[model samples]
Target: MVKARSVVQRIHLLQLALQITFRRTPLGVGMQNECWGAVAAELARLRGETVVAYYGISLREFRELIKGNKLTPAVMRNRVMGFRTLRFAVEV
Candidate 1:
């Protein structure tokens, strides 16, 4: 019984972590906005494109992408790192 309770607790914690890491919230809104803004600005400068496209994924889609069995951790890390690099490059 004790072991089962402990397992349940761990599962709950994992779920919470997944939510925080994958979900878009006010907590990370500023960083997200700044990153996308920098990307848009740089793209505009390079291609003279006045309108930038931001693809908004529905909650279900986001969860599917982030939590899908086929998506590896490395892929997710690369995506996040790439975004950060783009943001930094544009700022410089």
Candidate 2:
């Protein structure tokens, strides 16, 4: 059986996956995809959960929610900056 992961842990895992996409070298891809939406859908299927627990949401809803929401370290940094400045601040 799979061990339960706390919300913080799960979020951190997604963040790491996204951070892997950051380009570290020219012509080399740091990560081709930060596929949170895909992973959650497949994992839920593997666990035989028709619907996600705790969140009371379905795979389809999860996909829609996470769409374009790549929560990487860089992305977090940008968000933190915005909060600190109380304004929209991000580089590209």
Candidate 3:
């Protein structure tokens, strides 16, 4: 059961990581795209993957990378919900 618990914990951490990255990073705001590499690295760490392999996932491959991580539908939905809220809030 420890394994299952860790997975849940990782997902929760990933949520917070994504939220904080999106909330803090100046992504797509007329800034250079270099920061996306940092965002992808942070997420890949939580997803237990190589940062280089997903270095540009934040650019436009987010869903693909998330699918490759094998997260559940609920986690996927939660991610989408959080992303939408954050994106809209930034635009306003």
Candidate 4:
């Protein structure tokens, strides 16, 4: 249980970090190809895993969503909440 909770915490931290980083970085929030690429690379490096596999979202889809101006703060908040819920479940 402890190990599971640790893993959950790690994942939650990773998601929060990514969310903060992306929001604060002009390149990341702007949806520039280079920015998304950099974000994906950074995530891979930080998590030591492929970004698509870890996030369940492809870079192309992310770029398209950004290009379409479909990204919203509500969606991001929901994702954070979802991860928090996962972390809480593991703790219990």
Best by lDDT: 4
Candidate 1, residues 27-79: lDDT per residue as tens digits?
21222442322333344446553321222223343234333322334435434
Whole-model Cα lDDT of every candidate shown, in order: 0.33, 0.37, 0.41, 0.45
* lDDT of the structure predicted as candidate 3: 0.41
Deviating ranges (above 4 Å) for candidate 2: 1-34, 51-55, 58-61, 68-92
Tell how far residue 75 is off in model 3, in angstroms.
26
* Residue-wise C-alpha lDDT for candidate 2, range 44-64, written one tens digit per residue: 456565425622444554554
Q: For model 2, what is the C-alpha lDDT against the true structure?
A: 0.37
Considering TM-score, which of the candidate structures 3 and 4 is the better prediction for this target? 4
Off by over 4 Å in 4: 1-25, 28-34, 66-92
User: Which residue pairs in candidate 1 have backbone atoms (N, alpha carbon, C) closer than 3 angstroms, thus clashing?
Assistant: none
- Report the error of model 2 at residue 39, Å: 1.6
How many Å off is the CA of 85 in candidate 4?
A: 17
RMSD versus native structure for model 4: 7.7
**Which scores better on lDDT, 2 or 3?**
3
Q: How accurate is candidate 4 locally (lDDT)?
A: 0.45
Q: Given candidate 3, what's the lDDT at residue 80?
A: 51
Candidate 1 residues lying further than 4 Å off, grouped into runs, are 1-5, 26-92
Where is model 3 more than 4 Å wrong at Cα?
A: 1-22, 28-37, 43-48, 51-92
Residue 34, model 3, lDDT: 24
- Report lDDT (Cα) of residue 76, candidate 3: 49
The digit string of per-residue lDDT tens for model 4 on 1-92 reads 12233454446445644554446423334435434345544766687866445544445644554443324354353344334323433443
